[model samples]
Every structure is written in structure tokens, then in C-alpha cells.
Target chain A: MTSPEERLQAAQQVLASWAGDTQSPEPNRLDVGVAAQNLIAAIEALIGARWGYLSAITGLDLGVEAGQIEVLYHFCEGAAVLTLRVATPRASASVPSVCPLIPSASVFERELVEMMGIQVVGTPDNSRLFLADDWPDDVYPLRKDAVLERGVKEQGNE
Target chain B: MSEAVVQDKKRFVVPIGPQHPALKEPGHFEFTVDGEIVTGATVRLGYAHRGIEKAVESRNWTQSLYLLERICGICSHVHAMTYCLGVEKLAGAEVPPRAQAIRVLVAELERVHSHLLWLGVAAHEAGFDTLFMYSWRDRETVMDLLESFTGNRVNYSANILGGVKCDVTPDLASAILKGVDFLEERSRHYLNVVTTDEVFLQRTRGVGTMSKEVAERLGVVGPTARASGVARDIRIEAPYAAYADFPVQIVLAEAGDLEARFVVRIKELFESYRLIHEVIDKLPPGELQTRMPRKIKAGETISRVEAPRGEAFYFIKSNGSDNPERIKVRTPTLCNMGSVVATAVGHQLADMPMILAGIDPCFSCNDRTVAVRDAAGALVTWESLRQRRLAHQENK
Candidate 1:
């Protein structure tokens, strides 16, 4: 079995391949994405020898700047933490759920759905986790340009 | 005779609360009970949601330190410590040795205060007001000591981003040592009361029992997991601050019941005292705070510190700004609350309070609300009705 550092190096190699010129970014972090299906495979391949725990998945709302949504995956192997950033266009921001490979990602994905209006394709139970059932669908509160005053007032009354 | 007369039985529903004497915060739980046993429960929260995460976005790194301190009153220092560590990691600032020692001392002191408060609450839940008063009185000594050192009792706010705001003077260290002595003696007395007292044993021993396997699978931490024979302590696994230098022993138990949790917490008080003494004895002399640069470059870091209740995690993302672009807090109570469902599944209705208190859960942080629901899902307040039933039984 490959050691955790070896696996991390391999993963870094794989990420570097995809990162092209972006490889060897400052702080030794990289941003890359595979197809929704290949995402889990890449993670498994990267997390060799070490137990990879899905730390969290956060959804970033780019609004019109990138005309897309970016989902960040935080993975931890022992003490070493790494981030994998993936973007999907606003028109089609759906991504495959990693719950099959990492069970803890389910709650985070659900939270992303409630907070940023991102769709997690193949989520087992995509019901409301944090937000109430009656919360407006169009309002994504975490977006950079999200209207805070109105959301705060409406939530305050509820 | 039974075959001749079969009647369809209807299910009953009861609502526990959005407000109740049982809960300190407003949250609702609907329980479907089948003749004194809770068959099913659904929890509703967000009643006390203060938009803390959103609020952090607007506040500067310095101002946000105070905001995070209020996330939960019990583990205030832990919140500040974790937040400070995250920002420190981002800014590449290293805390001084003396500051780290002081931070560890305060953190352990906070744990003692929190555990003592928990004991009092647990005693109060069991209708033992005398024990409750004694425990709280002892707990006040630690709080007074904290006030003497930091100038505030609850929030403390002693931690800055790179280091601590307050320094422990020689006089303050002596006073803390004296306070620890008093707490150690009183804690021993309290332990005896909890262990040998017939009433406490009867009320807690087998009630809300969580098996080792169940506790592990649910990812329970701190006393709740320790009581179930799981040796998972973030302090031991990943030590930050002075913990990395002076390693403290992790307390564990095997029973996994309310009694076991009580023991683990009580034992932890002694461990905290030992740790505080260790930190104070090996006090180093150096600068308190390190100078952090004006701007933090775009980076993400995950930090975990062992809070009084369990492992508390902070994830901070900086976008080359003075303020954090994103901040996420994962309190231990959130993980420990899952085991409550499993433990309380078969417990008696009367044992609910003690069982719920066993985890020493910070529901205020966990977003918990209690609502009593009957089998058919109707809301009801059982306290008044239970009192009426008692009166009727007394008359009969």
C-alpha cells in the first residue's frame, strides 16, 4: 500500500496534470475538476493508503461574474487538508453527489443546496436540512450580491 | 374473549415545546409516544438563529473575535481560541510560548467551569437542588478566578488573533492555584456524592445507555463518547496551543450511560486542574502577541481544538482581505446530539430529562428545540397534565 504522503504526491501529480500551467500554485494548492462520475474516482485514487474523510463541501455563488457556481471540496487525510475547486455554469450547475464515496458529504451537499440553490444530482434525500420548507427558492443568501436587508427582515419575522 | 371483541386503537400526538421549562432555548420537538414510551421524535430548530455566519462576513478579523465568543457562553474561550488559531494560520503568525501557555491554562480553566456547571444542571434535572447549589457554588470559584485574570467572567475575550489580550500576573497565577486547590477538594466531594448516592445511581445508571458501537458510529465525542469506551480525544489526537507541549491525559469510561457520562465529566475536572497547574508551573516569559500582517493572502485552512464538550472545528477561507471570505464552525454538541436519539429510544418518559442532560449538550449551539408530540402528532404540554394526574392518583 502506498503511504499517505506518496498518495498525496500522486494526487498532486494528477491534479497538476489537469491544472496545466496552474500547477505549482503558491502554497502548493491546485484547482481542477473531472466529470461528475470521475470526480469520486480521482478522489479515491488521490487518497491512497490514508483514510480520506470528507471534511466539507461549500458552494460559492459567483452570480454573473463567472456566469457559474463553484463548489469547493475540503478533504482531510490525517492532518493534511486539501481543497479541490470545481465550477459549473449557472444554467447547468448540477454535480454528482459524493455521498456514495464519502457519507459525511451528504449533509454538506444538502446544506449547499439550501444555501446556494445548487442541485446535487443523485442525492438520496435532498429534503430541506437547514432552511425551512417555506423558504423562497429564488433567494440564495450566501451569494456575494445577495440582498441581505430583505432576507434579514423576512427571516426576522419568521 | 379477545377474538370476539377487537377494537381499533387510535394513535396520540404531543408537542414538547418551542417554549418549555425543560429547555433553556426555544426549539420544538414533536414526539409520538406509545403509552409512556417515545416511539418517534422530530426536532425543529432555527428559533435562536442569529445569522452568526453572515454577521462574520461584515466584521473585521479583530471585531469577529468577540462575535465568535458569543456563539456559546459555556465554551467561549474555545471559540476564541479556535478562531484565533485559524486566522493565525492564515496570517502565518506564531503565538509566543508564554501566550500559548496562558491560552492552555485559560482553556482548561474554562473546561472546569463548564463541567461543574454541567454537574449542577444534571443534579437539578434529577430534582437534587442541594447538590445543584453546591456544584454551582464550587463552579463560581473558577469563574471568579477567570474574572480576576481576564477582567470578565463569561465572554473572557482574552484571545486576540495572534495572541492573548490579557497576561497572567504572578498574583493572578497564585490566586488561580489557590482556586484550583479549592475546586479539587470540592470536586472530590461532589464525585463521592454522584457515585455513592443511591438516588443519583438509581436515576442515571442504566438510563439512556449508549453502546460502544452505537456511540462510535454516530461520531460522538468528548464525555459522551468516552462514556461509551471510545478513546477519541482531539487533545490527544491533534494537540494545538500548549497542549502540543504539555500533553494531558484523556479520561474514559465504559458504561456509556448517564452515570458514565457524569463520571467522565467529573473526572475531567480533576484532569483540568492538573493541566492548569502544569501550565502555570512551566510558565515561560516572552511577548504576548505576534504581529500579523495587514492582509491575509487567499488561502483556506482547517483548525480543530478540543473544547470542554468535545472537538470544536473552525474552517476559515481568506480572500486576501482583512476579513474572512468564509468562516464555518462545527461545534461538538452537533455530533453528540445524534447519539441522544439512539440512547433515548427505549428510555422511560420520566428519564428523559436526565438522559438528555447526560450528553451535556450545548443545545443553544446545536440549534435544538424541544416539542412534545403524541402518537397522532398533536401538540401538548405534559407537565400540567402530569401534575393533574398525580393529584388524581393522590386523591384515589
Candidate 2:
């Protein structure tokens, strides 16, 4: 297996612009912050080059003060994890769906939609995956501002 | 035939459990069928959603470990161990070498129990009740050892924040060795049963066949992908805990059918027994637990562990508080569920149970939310879900 540093360098060469600010916090991990618009391009570059498989997609709420939510697309090969960090304003949070390039992404994208309230633009299927049909609308439980009363009310109705 | 009769052969839907005979767990599945062959499949989960991910946020760093352990009953130790590994990494705490080895030892034993449990379940689905009974009866040997070692059978809670909670005593280690010897012999017989039994082979030899490429494309993990010849084990790839010290052999099967899944799991039992023996023989001597800070430093980290089902991915972000900012759990079943749905299509309705169980699905571990909306964008209730399932069942 190639060194994780070399893998990171190769990933940087694939994305010609804004490749300078990559962070290596732990061993075999490369984290790069990119604009929400460039999230799809960065991921396509990694997948096309056969860098790694999509391990997980984690959405983070920076809270009300920050007013922005971040999405981390983790690509893993062996022990190496190359993460693409994409941030969007929580007011109109949205990200381009990567399902067309990777079909398995539909499940994670649907999760982003329902839990974080982030609209996944162009995802083929956003059907209720693991949630009860009675789960209330506009209340993303994983979101920072998710109300407990809403989830409780929904449960009571059920 | 008549032309009208041919036209009348319309596709109908068959909705299996959120509560059906096919699955022991509670999860809904609707399969569109045409003349006993499945055309499409859809799944609805969250019947067992405990909101653990969200609830963990409200609890403190240490408290969340116990909460996370309850995520899956079968792989509870792995759940806690994975969480502890991530939290420790984020907190900048180092786990002692002996603790790491102990963690690996328990994890391997859990693997034995889980695979045996799966083998029995898959056999039961294939109408091989005798093998089911035999495998499950053999599984208790591992379970008993786990209880004697950790004091609990199902959720051992053996793993703590920094390291493991329980230490392996001389008596316990010898007892485990004796149990391993018994299991190794039984596993060989099981391997022979699945590979050579003519009737069992008929049910699994060609059913749910998946190529290596399809398995990789669907992101299947653990033994499921390994059976298809995809070498994606996390322990081998990223040697966490004591894996770097004592490596385990990777078991592979060429054919990606149900039988391959069986062979891969059965073969893994041999590998686990070998690893367990190695761990006990080289049982390290040191402190079982490590010291930790009350407030974790502000940071985020990813912990990937090869749970019995597959890769249990944990993403933990700490905001310099006692409580975590966010914890995202991407379970293996979530990845393999796509493959199951895809494989279910075009297979005989009778083989659907074996195919779904072949992946060893754990709906409770993979449980999350799905938002079903109406014309006004309102949420659909559980009553409506039951009605929809009933309507489909009535149609059949």
C-alpha cells in the first residue's frame, strides 16, 4: 500500500485549485476544506482516480452563532481517510447529490435531508428510509435547533 | 393462454416485516412481485429507532459510552469499544498495550458468537432446522465464556472509555482456551455441512450470487464483501487496538452466492479461534484501565472498527465540553442494505428470506428516520404505515 501522505498529494494534484490548505491531524487522514459548490468535483476526482471508497458522510451543525452547517465526505482506502469538508449557510442549506456518481450515496443523502434538514439537490430517491412516516416535518432531530417537544408530540401521535 | 389471461398477470406488491415471519427484527419491506419473482424492493425502518444518536448529545462524555453500547444487542461490545476508541482518540488519551490486546481478544470471541448466531438464522431460513439447532447450541460455548469473563452475556459492557473494563485472569484465560478447543472442532463439522450437504447446497449454492464488482459498487462490508473476494477488513487495512501486534488471517470465498457467505463466516470461526488462542498464549500483563480527563479537548476524529456485521464507522466531534457536539454512526448494515435490496430483485419470492438474512441484517443497529410526506408536506403516522403494509398484504 502507498503511504497516506503520497495518497494525499495525489488527491491534491487531482484537484488543481485550493489544494494548499489540507490538514493531517492523525495518521492516514487528510482533511481539506472546500466550497459547497466544489464538493461534487472534489469527490468525483477522488472516485475517478480510484483513491478510495465512500466510508461515511457526516453533517455538523456549527450552532446558531456560526449560522453555517458543515458536511464531511469521508473517502477511505485501507486505513487512510481523505475528507472533503463542505459548509453551507443554514438558512438555505443545500448540497449537490453525489448519488449519480455513487449509487450507494442515496442512503446517506436521504439521511442528510431528514436529519440535518439539508436539501440534497438532485438525489433520485429521498423516501423515508429508516424514519417513521409520522415523524414531523421541518424538524431535523440532529440539527442544533431541533425541538424536543416536536419529537415527543410526534411519538405521542403514533 | 388467452390474451386476457396474459394481460391479467399484473405485478403485485408483498410487504414483509416491520412484523413478518421472514425477519426476527422489526423493519418493513415491500417487494413488487410478478408471478413469484421479485421485480423491485423497498424498505422502511425506524420501528426500533431509540434516538440514541440524538440522546447521546444530551449525556456527558462518559455516560454516552453506556448509551452507545445499547445500540445493538448482538455487537454491543464492539459498539462500546468503537465509541471508546474514538472518544479516547479525540481526548488525546493513550490506551495501554495490554488493554488493547484484551479489547481484541473480547472482540474476536464476540465475532465467534455473532457468526454462529448468523449461521443458525440463515439455516433456519433455508429450512435446515437441524443445522440451525446444532450451530446455536454450539454458539452457547462462546456465550458462556463471555459471561464468565465479563459477567454479562449479551451486553458485556467490557469496554470502558480509555480501555477495557475487565481483565483476563489465569483461570478465565484457561477456560476460554478449553471453550475454543471445543468450538474449533464443531466449526469444522459446520464447514463440512454447508459445503457438502446436498440439500443445503441446493438452497444456497446459486442463490443471491454477487460478483466482486457489484459488492464493491454497493459498498458491502465485513464477511459479506469478503465472501465475494473483496479484501476490505478494517483490522487488516487500519490495524487498530492489538491488530498491529497480532494479525488475524483474512478468510475469502470466490463465489458471491449464499453458500459463499456461509463458507466465509464458517471459515472466519477458524480464524477467530486461532486468534483467540494466540491472544491467550501471549496475554500481555499490565493495567486494564487508563486515566482520562473529565473534559475532552475540542476536536473531531473517526474510529473505524470491523464489527461482526462489518465496518462500524463512528464520527465523534467534541467541542471542548464534557458532552460531545455530534456523533454519527454509519453502520455496516446501512451499506449492505443497498446490496440486499438490489439482490432481492429477480430472485424467487421463496428465496427472499435467505437472501436478506444472508447479509445478516441488524435493523436496530441501522435504525434511523425517514420522512414520508403527503400533499401538504405533513408527516405520515405509524397508523398509516400499518395501513399501507396491510393494503399491500391484502392485495397479495
Candidate 3:
């Protein structure tokens, strides 16, 4: 029954313990930067307080130059969107699977593992969701510096 | 996990393909059975993965719009409109109210057509071809209206960067009203059949029931979650486009079974019919297009739109450039797909296909990809795309 603003304020209060740097990108959106270690605790807090449902998990590569891969876990309550931003080193990109907290997160984590080449420790299944089985490992196509071959060849063209 | 007698080390698995006619998409599902009762189930999708998310990172603001539109054949307008709304939100461009109304109008029409298509498919899966045939035949009414109104039927391309492309003319408005009227009556009959038909009810009732607790824990979305009585509709909870101006009530069912899924979707059709009429009758009067900058400012924006199946979420990040830094699309099918695996357990193995269809799962929606031929798929210039299309046509 609370308004979106009230809900968002409540989220800010919930995550106040773990959020490192909080920013309001939009009027209804709250962006909280959390260390990779604190990501789980912050998420547990949100769900524990019944803040909102996890809307999506977005993986971002800050380009080859930045040497950082960022994962955004977005939770939505009404029109309010609260994002938990976690950045990891590109070479050993890893995020503790929130699947332990949110089982549905396994799907998003699987896609992230293959697409962005992030290591999601403790995910139920690390199998490919989009990439082919014989596809080369460690070549994350979504990475800014991924070396993608020409368009997929037709079955006979090979 | 079931009360049914468990056989020692029994793992008789039934695999429904990455290509099977029963479940019409390129998804592989495995169900472990013990004496006709499913013990455990797992689904593997993405056979048709198109690499579109990776492709969007390379394409500039506008080209990505058309690519995102094709994310789902059934809910293409929602994809396009959601992209437009995200891009506009980042660019700080204001879409005209009239254009927003048209966007909602087209979105509601898409919802009606999508629900009808699901009804037919679910009916077919349940071996109720009579209802299937009738529903598919009646679905053409909305299809024809969409084709006439938006030009193409499935991927209508009805949305532009700042606003929508199509407008509701007086002629089109009258035609749409007439079309919805016919659909309203047909939808009522189908609803009655799905709710009351005894034979069909046998397949759907008390089958694959998902309680509200299970629905929330698994994070199922759209009609599937609503059927479980989870009040999680993006349209009502977080109104976007013109949904704010014209609102629709949330549809819910307590049973949380295949029948409830049927009831929830059919009831939604009536809600859509009302929204369509509301948008057309109160068609805002103003310009349809707004100016957008070539290079969008650096920012992060999340746009959540309620697609036919569920909530379609988009996360767009721009590094103050023409091309997006990162674009992530989390379709509703992915959210509800988990529920199928969780609920499929303990049900009769024969009911697997019907339970799968209850969520109206779209594999291609979850498997979005781009046909990249170069370093970054973003180098696909419009001219090259046109040349490729021309070559493809000549080859055909």
C-alpha cells in the first residue's frame, strides 16, 4: 500500500548497511554500488524486508580499457527500480551465485557465465543456455574485446 | 519428492527435444519418471539463440530498435516500444501523448492476438483440437486488424525511437472498434469453453498447480504468476507508455493450475479489449514523432514492460556515445520457465507438454542473438543489411 517513493526510501534504508556509494540515477530509480563480497548480504536484506521482486540481472563489461566487469541486479517495486551494482576484475570475473538466495537466478547466472565469461560460483548448473557445446570456451562474445568469427556458416557451407 | 512409491535407483528419463513437434520450439526438456509419475524435470533452451544482445552493443541507438523488436514474434510491439521508451528515457526526449496512446493501442492489440494464439496452442497440446481449431480461426480477427492497422501482422515495426510510427485514423478507429467487438464475443465463448468443458477440464484442472508461495519464490511472471494469485503485472504495478493514463485491473485466480492459467489469460483478453477501446476512444491529439539526438548521453536506464507472457525487462547503458555500452534483455519467458521445471515434478509424465504450454513459454524470446559476421556485430551498416536482404531475395 505504500507509494513508490516510500518503497524506494525503504529500500535505501534496507541497504544502508552494505551500500558503498548510493546514487539516484532517475527519480524512481536507486543505484547502489556494492562490493562483490557484500552483494549477497544486500540482496538478502532486500528480500528479507520484502522490498521487491528481482526484475532482472544485467552484466556489463566496462570495455577492455576499464578492466572491470559489472553485474547489475535490478529489483522492481511498483515503478521504483533498485539496482545493486557489483564490479569484478575482468581476468577473474566472479560473483557468488545468488541462486542460493533466489533459485530463479540460476538461469540469469548461466547466461552471464557464457555471455560475459563471469564465474558464478555455486550456481546449480553452469551449462550453456545460448552458446553451442563445441563453441570455444573463454571466448565470451559479449565482452568488448571478444574475437567473433564471421557470421555462422550455413550447415553445408562449412 | 512424491508420495508415490519410489523405486530404488529409478531414473527412467524422457527427453523432449531441442526439436520436437509436441512442444513446437527448439527447447530440450528431460523428465525423470517412476511409474508414470515425474520425479524431477529440467529444461535446456537456446537452440535458436540469435546473439542479439551481443549484437546490440555494437549497433547505434536506432538500428538496435529493429533488432530488439524481433525478440518475440508474438510480442514484437512490446519489445520495440520498450526499447523506444528506454532510449527516450536515456536521451531525455519527450514522446508526444498522441504517439504514446497509439503505442498502448498497438500493445493491447498485440496482447489479444498473443493470448488467442496461446489458447489455440495450449488446446492443441491438450488434444482438444476442436477448441484449438476454433480458437486459431477466431484469432485471425485480431491478426487481420493488426495487419490492416500496422501494415505487417507479426513484427509490425509499429515503434520508432522517440514515438510510435502508426497513428489511429478515424477509419482505422472505426474498423478496430468493429474488430474488437467481434473478438469480445468470441473471447467470451472461449472463456466459457475453457472453464466449463469437462473433457478439457480433465487435462487442466488440478494439474501442475503452483501455489502463491511457489510462484513468488521461483519468480514467475505475467499470467503464470497472476494465475497463482501473485499480484505482479508490470502494467498495473509500474505503468509505462500510456498505461498510466488508462489503467486496467489485475486479473487473478487462486487455483494456480493449468485451468487457472487458462482462466487468467482469457480474462486478460477482456481487459485488453477494454484498454484497446479506451485508447482509441480517448486517442490523444498531437504530433506523433519527436526529435532524438544521434549520440545519447551517458546513463543507465531500466525499462520494464508487461509483454504478453510476462514482464519484459531491458537494461540500457550508454557511455555518452551513439552506441550503447551494454544492452540486456530479460524476457518474461525466462522468468516463468523456471516454474515449469519446478511444477512439472509429481505430475503425470503425459501432462508435461500441457504444463509446459500453460506458461506460454517462448524459446526464441529467451534465445535472442545476432548473426554477426565481423569483429563486433555492430559494424552491420544499414546499407550492408539492405544489400544482404537483396542478395537473400535474389537467391530465393
TM-score, every prediction: 0.82, 0.92, 0.94
lDDT of 2 by residue, B1-396 (tens): 001112224667777776743558877777888888988888777777877888889889888998899899999988999999998888788888899999999999999999999999999999999999999999999999999989999999998888888888899999999999999999999999999999999999989999999999888999999999999899898888899989978889989999999999999999999999999889788888789898999988999999998999999999999998899999999999889889988899888889989999998898834345667666686567789899999999
Pairs with steric clashes in candidate 2: A131-B369, A131-B370, A133-B380, A134-B380
**Model 1, range A1-158, lDDT digits (tens) per residue?**
34445545655675553432233232323345555555666666554533444545667665577788777776544344456767778766778887665543555676677667788987765766555556677766666666645444533432
Instruction: Please state what fraction of the native interface contacts candidate 2 reproduces.
Output: 0.67
Higher-lDDT candidate of 1 and 3: 3
Can you tell me the DockQ of model 2?
Answer: 0.48
The 0-to-1 C-alpha lDDT of every candidate, in the order given, reads 0.73, 0.87, 0.88
* Candidate ordering by DockQ (highest first): 3, 2, 1
Ranking by lDDT: 3, 2, 1
Interface RMSD of each: 8.2, 5.8, 5.2
The worst-scoring run of ten residues by lDDT in candidate 3 chain B lies at: B1-10
Better of 2 and 3 by DockQ: 3
In candidate 2, stretches whose alpha carbon ends up further than 4 angstroms from where it belongs are A18-21, A151-158, B1-10, B368-396
Across all candidates, what is each one's fraction of true contacts kept?
Answer: 0.05, 0.67, 0.69
Model 1 chain B poorest ten-residue lDDT run? B1-10
Candidate 3, B1-396: lDDT as tens digits: 112333447567777776752557788887888878988988787788988888887788898998888888889999999889998999999999999989999999999999999999999999999988998898899899999988998999999898877877889899999989998999899989999999999999999999999999999999999999999888898889988899989999999999999999999999999999899888889999999999999998989899999999999888998998888999999999999899988899889889888999898898974443446434454467788899999999
Judged by DockQ cut-offs, the docking class of candidate 1 is incorrect
